[model samples]
Target chain A: MTAWDVIGFLLVLATAAGIIIFSSKQVRGKYPALFRKIPAITRLKRAVGLSVEDGSRVHVTLGKADLTEAANTSTLVGLSALHSIGQLSANSDQPPICTSGDGGFALLSKDVLRAVAMETNTREYYDPDLGYLSGATPFSYALGALDALEESGAKTNVLIGNFGVEAGWLTGNAEKHAQFTLAASDSLVAQAVFMATSQDFVIGEELYAVPAYLAYRPAHIASLRVQDILRFLVGGALLIGALLKSLGLL
Target chain B: MKILNIIIAVAAGLIVLLGYFFRIPAIDDLRGQLLNWAVTLSGVAGLIAILNLIFGVHWKRVKEKHERRGASLVIIISFAVTLVAGIFLGPSSPGFQKLVTHVQVPIESSLMALLAISLVVASLKILQRHRSWMGFVFFLCVVLFLILNSGVLAFTSEIPVLRDFLSAFHHAPVAGARGILLGIALGSLAAGIRVMIGSDRPYNG
Candidate 1:
């Protein structure tokens, strides 16, 4: 809202645009993996593949990410991962199930599923019921997901989005019922719970690294490149700010 | 059709973005209108989703003769009764408020109590499941913070070096958390810019 805030936003926007344009080209012809190995993503991908072979569904629960909040970023990350997984598991007997706590996000998730289904020529196997809003509130969402997870009988559970302390129930339930489970969230509180309960807890921004790891597609790779560049820029900014403040110049 | 969807979405997003940067009266009005429409649509979608979730879950159970059929019926009844009561008596009504205060709060509190127990069991299981150095370090850090910050050792604060060390330890998580938050912010910006450039479109699948 202030001048400095606007300047900062525009600075980031310009940098992102530059990197995105550059990386879009570089991602062509099998770019080398630029990211570290994430064990959680490895397990998540394997769980999806194993679900395909075993003919069980992979349950993807995206907790409430209201459009008006910053947590919607995590929802975008979730949607991308879902799309990648949808394409990867398109030929399976049962398509992955997507659940959300918000209706708008549920709609977006359903669209991603439908689009993936269409592109893969698996329209016949796709069901509209595959995507749904689970519950309205935090605890209700978790309790609702518990019932849904039980009913679906999915072997693999992947929970990614904006979760709160209420995620304890869903992760606890998944731990008990599912064969493979990995949970991630943008909320620090939820992340704490996940570290303790979930089979694989994706820490920090590794949640954002999911699509690049899962799909290995060009666009996601480009996004990842932009992210890395921005991280360096941010780290440099932090160091500069610290030095300036220490010298009484900031 | 896909191109049109992308264009429409991008255009609307641009307008919204512009509204944030500029405080012009006309742009502000337009932004308000657009946001109002979005809120209305979101509310309608929520209503539809709730109804679908309630009826669909219970209906499928009943039709399929699932073991939870009886429980499903009870849920359906509870949802309908609650909906009817909420609509007729209004959300601000004392009885409706009691439904939240008396029933919902107790249930949520019990679950929170369960979460505390779960946290303890999960920490123990962390050792059993993940015996790596990272796991050990994580467990050590958490336990160290827990014990140190709990005022269990007041004598340590009397020593200047120990007090300084403990103070720094208390602030360590904040620094780490701030670093993580910065990473997330950068990632969000990248993701949002991708949408703007049409490199990613989760809206139309």
Candidate 2:
């Protein structure tokens, strides 16, 4: 490999190490206090409560992106959100049903739901099939999810993850049924943006803050802090690099 | 059996990677054969999925005639027309190519264009709703990129300062975007590594 290639590879490795280290530390140490103060976390409980009181099923979608996809943070956030929703649902008469687009996510979602149910002492509510794997195709998954939501009479839909243009179709369908929707995705796709605007609440990178808010995972919180620090550093570097380059300086 | 299937999946994935990056004659031939087999399997899978959709929709229509009947009819008509045409004329035939060009392309393109328009409208709504600094920055970047990409400002080269500024901004944003993208890529890489190592075994069940 060339010298430039070696440097680039090392830089990438260092960044990955930094994120993992920061996230892991935050997960272990300073997450609880951070979780307590997040307004979005509080709103989630209120949403879940409204669903339970109205005797409506809580609809959760983990998106079509798999854990190995670039949007792994979305998967983590979705699972964390599910954990909170599952716990809340356990206390209420209405149970939560999760629909996933990826097989691996479906499997993880089931475990997350089951764990929450067990934690809430509502193990009986835990069903293996509670986490349904819809079609892997974007439109097919959206169609299946919409069908399930309509059939189940879901009152509140919380969708988080990476989605494509077809997400608007699901959001529009959900809205037509008068279901309160809170959706978030990191996708820059216009369709995803459209769905988010139509929903009651839409979170962006804020989706990554869920684990920090819910479990008080120190690593997750620290990771966010680190991400902010990195963002500032990168922004400064960009400005300086542009200035230097314009001046014919390396 | 599941373990063996997983092992085979891993091996096949590795082979595909090798086939893509390496330049060996025997490996290339092996890769070609494997690709053909994979495509055949994918075609079969697609066929099965379509069949399932047809059956599922028809069954729902049969069971609930009032609501699903229209959807079922549309599915049936689309399937029958496409299938019959393909079977008779074959994919490369002039008749099949004409249908593809005249009917399929226009319909698909129009639908895609509609979706794209909706997406743009939705993106504007997101900007209006969020109104955060980051959101504003993202929205601004997108608008600027779109204007430049759409060739609307191609005639503006008559203004020297404006031209230089636009060129500089374009080149400058690339570096910033590259940096941000790198951070995102690193974060994603970590997460993927965690999953592969089974540390993030949320799907282990």
Candidate 3:
């Protein structure tokens, strides 16, 4: 919108890129303080492991996000989580099942699933049906995914993406039927619903921390490091703005 | 192929992202074309998904004689009828539009009502099932907001302290929502940078 805003945006990206390079080159170092331990993420890890042992599939639903829309980043993060889970469960007796509400997202997820299946050398387990387009709209998504999930026989539900209050039905359904459930959403309303219904949930930026928790890659750690630094900067900016406002200098 | 894919992704991402900040005609033109392609791809993807839903999911269920075969059959029939009607009658036709307004709108409205009730039910279980300080705080906030927004606290607003409290209540959700929005924005920035740099590749499968 303005030069200052553009500079600030670029700074965030540059900072993330810089840390990613730095973190990747390090031979050994402690994980960032912010991501050292996240209970919800740790629980999701445990859920995946338990799923493997129980031979029950994990269900991941990427709430409807079009690539051209504002919520695409949320869907991308959901894909990150789904990719991690797919690899983790690729060799298991039962693999993970994923669903999306948007057609484009569903298409991309299907490709991701197939690729994960191939990489994990579990081609037999790869069903094109593994990734489903549950619905085209919000309410239809809830109803369609409810049926798809029920039929998948998945014991764990990992919902990460953009969702509406319609997510309440899905999370509520999981509460009754699922052995484990965790949710994260880009939509504030859906996040609130998840908190009320789901046993474990990542709120706000914590949704982006899933990859770091699930797979200890350098890039993932770098992402957390960048988030921590930027969050501090944002907090400082907010405080200064508040001070300025109170002093009538803003 | 992987290298080529990354190259293409990074190049397209860079061009599109920079197009907003830069005023070059070539870059803007390229960005527009890229965006158009993306939309086309999205539409095709949607079509593929519908086909998958019909043939891979419902049709299979029907053929397999699953317990939900009846529901699958109904979905298949409805999809066929809708597709045919839309093709013949055109989506702008009054009959087709009415089908949406009368049939789909009412169904969606009913689902919305159900979703609200479901949220209430989940709220009832929050403190009981969770039993954490966070759960208690969330539950308290929900009740507080509900009471404030329900007009029950309007009379109390005449009192000085109550008025101040009500003012804070009005702004509380906004403040909380703003904070969350900031966090989400930063998170998205970090994630987008990751993808642009090819450090994290969701498309790489």
Candidate 4:
């Protein structure tokens, strides 16, 4: 590795480790809001509560992100959100159904649901059927999810992950059925689809932030905090790079 | 056990990640081997899931006189036939390719067609509801993109100023898209670091 690569990697590692450690040690104060206001999250909370009261299932679909490097992070973020949904649906008559296009993602979803069930002391309600491999590709997965949504009569549909243009199909289906739909994606096309279809859609890093809001675990909060800091650092770097280029100093 | 697994995960993850950046031969070999194992395991898992879906879910549903028994039967037969054809004739064989080309391609094309309609409906909905400048801008861009591609305004390309304006307008959204993509990349990198460090353990369960 080059010196710059090694230095950059170590810098990030150290900074993240320090932040995580410090954040973990902090306790709640009188005014202890760790993150900024996300209106979509507030709406999500209300939607989940309403869905529970109305005896309708919340459908959570992690779109067609497989175990490849290009999509692995999106899958992980989806799983994190699924973790929150699992907890949210714990007391409800209808627990959230987690579906994925990839088998590996589906298997991981099952594990997350199982963990949630265990945490909620609802192990008996834990069903592997709840986390399913819907289809192998994006379109097939969307169609499969649409079928499930129709059959289950789910009131709330939360879609997150690496959906493509096919996300429009699922989100449109939800809207047509008058389901309360919220969506987030790493894909720009899918994000556009979500913005068009979902009334309250999480944008960009907001998908990762939802889990922190739902669970408020120190680690999740710390990770979000670090992400924000890193984002700012990137923004600063971009500005500086632009300035240097304009000045012909590079 | 959990601690051990976490350590293993971190170590293996670090090895694979660094192997990409660093040109260490040993780490590269290790990365390749681990990736192969992952792919192989994933393939096996997929096969098992397919079999379970066909037999454990679809077959059981058919046997139990479910409402969608016909659908279940169709799924099972199609899956079985595809699997057998794929195995016996080989995945590259004409039958398997034809099955994919005829069935999968058409389904994908249908979804794409649906996406076009949905996009129009969605854009219209946005205009009707939001009626904001940004929404109007989006709608205008969509229209312009469609018109440009439709070849109805192909003669506009002959006009230098009009062509420049159209070209710049077409690429404007792409710039915004690139910014969003950069943000996603940075966010993903940060999140991946969290996972690697075991702070945000989606794999824990």
- Give the top-scoring candidate (lDDT): 3
Can you write out model 4's per-residue Cα lDDT over A1-250, one digit (the tens) per residue? Answer: 7898887777567656755664555533432545678877788878888888888888888888877546678778888888887788788867788777888787888888888888899888777777777777778788878877776788888888889888888887787663578788888888888777667687777777777787777767666666767778778989999999999998
Model 1 residue B90 distance off true place after TM-score fit, in angstroms? 0.8
Instruction: Please report the TM-score between candidate 1 and the true structure.
Output: 0.95
lDDT of 2 by residue, A1-250 (tens): 4576566556444544655665564544654333335554566667778888888888898788854445656766687678767776776766788876766566667778777776788887676666766555676577777876876788888777778777776675677664577766656552235433563544444555655555554445555665566567767887899899999996
Say what the RMSD of model 2 is: 6.3
Q: Candidate 4 — which pairs collide?
A: none
Q: Which of 1 and 3 is the better model by DockQ?
A: 3
Clash pairs (backbone) in predicted model 3:
none
DockQ head-to-head 2 vs 3, winner: 3
Tens digits of per-residue lDDT, candidate 3, B179-202, equal 999999988888888888788887
List the candidates' TM-scores in order: 0.95, 0.65, 0.95, 0.91
After superposition, candidate 2 runs with Cα above 4 Å error: A1-42, A66-73, A190-192, A199-204, A236-240, B1-154, B165-183, B186-190, B193-200
The interface root-mean-square deviation of each model, in the order shown, is 2.0, 5.8, 2.0, 2.1
A1-250 per-residue lDDT for model 1 (tens digits) = 7897698668657855665665655545456646788888888888889889989988888988886666688888889989988988987979888889998887787788899888899989888778888888888788878777877888988898999888888887787778998898888888888877776888887888888898866667777776777778778988999999999998
Q: Which window of ten consecutive residues has the lowest lDDT sum in model 4 chain B?
A: B48-57
TM-score between predicted and true chain B, model 3: 0.93
CAPRI-wise, candidate 4 is: medium
